[model samples]
Target: MLTVAHSVPKTPEHEETIHKAQYNVARAYFMGFGAPSSEDDGRRWLDRAAADGTRRGSVKAQTMLAMLFARRDTLDLEKSFHWHSEATGNGSLESQGALGVMYLYGLGVRRDLVAARLCLTQAARRGNIYATGQLALFYYRFRFYQHAVRFGTHLARFEAADVAELARQSECLPGYVRRGLATGCYVLSRCQLLGQGGLAADGERGRLLGGRAAELDAATADRLQRLFVNGPWSCASYPDLGVEV
Candidate 1:
């Protein structure tokens, strides 16, 4: 009997389809979307999808694994950072933003503000709303109020969807968009109220912005108020503000 050795499809289209299917399978297992929900199985499939190819893994899979490892009950910050780094090298905007956050918070490595700023700036310039919001917060913390205002204003004026519509269909919006919008409004309100960030004192506008922040995401709004408004702000002591990309 002749032995047969199986090889991965050489066609790029075929390889792409296989990788996508692997991701879909992982998602289905994770979410119970036409499949039984099983985190173990989901993780297994995700690993396959993320580490299968001769080239770097699938960006989506790498990013998702990073998020999963960072957030799951059994957290693994090192694994998360590794995958995010890998995906960032692949030019994934989401991973770039995530890497920035990890660096800012010292999640899996030594905290490095310069590295965080570099990663956040690259992602923010490429339209990563999460990165933009984080950059605003970073600048604000460092007293670079002008830069904070610039980034915050961009998020505050996100007009892709009407506020009322977004409120009515919050679930339809990406987590990053909602969180970014809320963070922007909250930051701007603080700026206006305190006359920082190159903004004049405007309690009325600040109040309105505060209200808008609540509308976009009450939980995020509450978190920001508790961490930055009602108490002394400390980035090291701040709670997680991760965007679910």
Candidate 2:
């Protein structure tokens, strides 16, 4: 399946088709979808896909490369930044969100709330639901100039209503995000846990939301499993999130 794509060179004759084929083959291999998984082949094909220079969906290849290099075990932050910067410059909301997260955690670049805000804003404005959730979680309008102060200020100004607004907006999200449904449900579930938006603190609601998210997307389910520590929905103990986003 993987070699089938490269058998026919990607030329001007069938550039779009070839690019799509290569990307599909690479994604299939990467995900082991009816094919033997091989990261090396997947990465090679993704590189070819990005090199195709198709502005339309090349961001997907670039984002994949960025995440591949940014794996915690690999820790090649420079390459991660390089790919993410490419995707971000190409107007990829997912890449923008990822770059914002990198800046926020100082993964590759220095920690800078300004940079984070810029990237997050770019993604959120384009209707990246996860980016919207991040924006609601971390507000950066104030001129705090320090991490602790900025963080404290955001917490102080945080309101439960904001969660409801964010959730309402993310209900019908764009298709650009592969896990938009799962992410939205997860964010809303967190809000439920916190008793935000005039809602009661309900662990069952949180679990139900998590389960629904997992049903919609397996990746989201895996993320929920990590957060729950037991299953997709159940939690041994809920954390204390008192008025803090």
Give per-model TM-scores.
Answer: 0.86, 0.56
* lDDT to native, each model: 0.75, 0.58
lDDT of 1 by residue, 1-245 (tens): 00111126468765655666777788888999887899998888788778642344567888888888776575788888888888888767778888998888787878898999999999878777767788888888788998888888888886536544543433222676677778887888888888997799999998988898888778888888888856565444465546232
Q: What is the C-alpha RMSD of each candidate to the true structure, in Å?
A: 5.1, 9.9
Cα lDDT tens digits, model 2, 1-245, are: 44645666555646545666778888988898877999887888898877633464456677777777766565587778778888778766677777876676566678787898888777767656556544544431232223322222232232323434544453322332324445555555655666654457899976776566566556644754465455322112211111001
Predicted structure 2: lDDT: 0.58
Whole-model alpha-carbon lDDT for candidate 1: 0.75
Clashing pairs in 1: none
Regions of model 2 farther than 4 Å from truth: 1-4, 7-13, 52-57, 140-245
CA error at residue 38 for candidate 2, angstroms: 1.5
Report lDDT (Cα) of residue 111, candidate 2.
76
